[model samples]
Target: MRGKHAPRSTRWPIIILVIIAVILAPIIYGASSRNRTTKNQTTVSKKTSHSSISSSSSVKSSSTSSLSQSSSSSDVKLKSAWNTTKNKQLSAFMSQWQTEMNQTYSGTYDGQKPDYYGISFPTALENGRLSGHIKFDNQNTTVEWSPNANSSAKNQVLAVAVGQTSSNGYNRILYLFIAQEKQPKVYVSQTTNGEDLYFTETQNTALKDGFSQIYNSN
Candidate 1:
């Protein structure tokens, strides 16, 4: 009878210990799993923030690059305009003048033929106007004169002759560079004292007024 009671009491204590161990093991495991989940959420949020910052920086960089390219293109256009009117056009004009003067005055004026020795580069003026000087010498006499080329809406080329002398300041000659409205008919006006030489339909009064404007502007 004693042996049986002792065995039953020992069995009761062992069963109680097993039941407590089962409950405590689940509690500890649940707490550890919750901590791991919280840690993973924090790490994911940091990575997302970093990615957003990097994307925003790339957009700003692209904007800056575009602005730089636009500014460079604008500068190139300005330089092209500055270099368009070169010495070649001036040389051509001098050759034309030489041919015209040779035909008009015949052999020579004051022992030497009319010639253009030098020219000033055409410069941009106000309101789409261009001005330059053409220099020529005849019989040891040097003549410096300026040409004003005005461009208009109808693709018109109006050139004014401004004459200057050491004795006097400036003289207005009745010469022009005119083109037809839709044709490429460039001409230097002929001087007839009282007659309109080039562009037969134009009047002397209008020619004089136009020359005056160019002369005064120079």
Candidate 2:
């Protein structure tokens, strides 16, 4: 004889519950994983958007700076081109020097060669200060000189030899003043003729032309 078994319907409910749990496990896990992937994608999209905005701003700023620099350069050139006062002043200054030399400048000997005058311009007008040189055509000599004064520095001898000379071609003496106007002075002076120290005040002359040439055109 054997013991009696449990009722058949009591085991049916338990078997059905087990089957339901097995099927739903994979579906629940899939749903949870899909939700996490969507969240990650949103975060990545935000980062990309922020990076693009920053890059665009940098490019815009660089382009703006370049445009500003170009505009500034153009303005400067335009200003220089339109400066009329300096041109007129420079031309008159040259004329005055030519006139004075013809009348007052004397040579050491008779029949000294005449000087040819030409002007040197600065890169910018900068108030029209300029330099020049005089070529002594007859003597085959040239001197780059500018107007000087008693306070001017012609004291140092050219070579410890007697520097001052009366020859029109050598010492390259300039009028102490030109028309009482401010004169352009160069850093250095040179002459192909014999060296001369500063000329006496008598050798230097001034006119009322109200303009002075700036420097030696050596």
Candidate 3:
């Protein structure tokens, strides 16, 4: 009866099942919590990435706008460099001979007070010359100048000092032009001054002598 009256093995199986269930419960819960934390981290990462991309896009847009404004300001400077009449006329004149029109130009010049702007013109110079005059505040001084080359019998630049002016301390209005003779172009300058100053004659004569040295017809 001692051996035969022993409890059935079925009770042992049931006890084993209960013990296994108790041991697995905490492990399953911990695994589920870890999975939920991982999911939350992934969501946060996605949000951060999206925000970074959006911020970068905004920065690029702002930079482009700033560049555009800078270019526009440069354009304003170039327009103001010459007188209104001469500016319009020269712009029209250059347009007629140009093949390529795209240019990015910005620089400084001597005459511009505080700051100067460097402007670029069209490169193609055909069989013709472009010219214009810039007048200063003084009535007697008129700068008659052309930067383009004259298509004459000699095929050379015709920059000359016609009126009275001096290169000394006095402020002379320069008639500026670009001479398109060959690959590299020359900048032609002419000075003008009132009759009262005898120094004006000296300046004019000196400039004329210098011009003759460079562009002598003979």
Best by TM-score: 1
Which portions of model 1 miss their true places by more than 4 Å?
1-8, 84-218
Model 3 clash pairs are 107-118, 147-177, 147-178, 147-179, 165-200, 166-203
After superposing candidate 2, which stretches have Cα over 4 Å from the reference? 5-19, 82-218
TM-score of each: 0.43, 0.35, 0.37
* lDDT of candidate 1 at residue 138, scale 0 to 100: 12
Candidate 2 residue pairs that clash: 132-217, 133-217, 144-218, 145-216, 163-196, 163-197, 164-196, 164-197, 184-214
lDDT for model 2, please: 0.38
Q: What's the lDDT for residue 8 in model 1?
A: 40
Model 2 Cα lDDT, one tens digit per residue, 66-143? 999999987764444212353344445545654655533422111222231221111111232221222222222212
Clashes of 1: 0
| TM-score sort, best first | 1, 3, 2
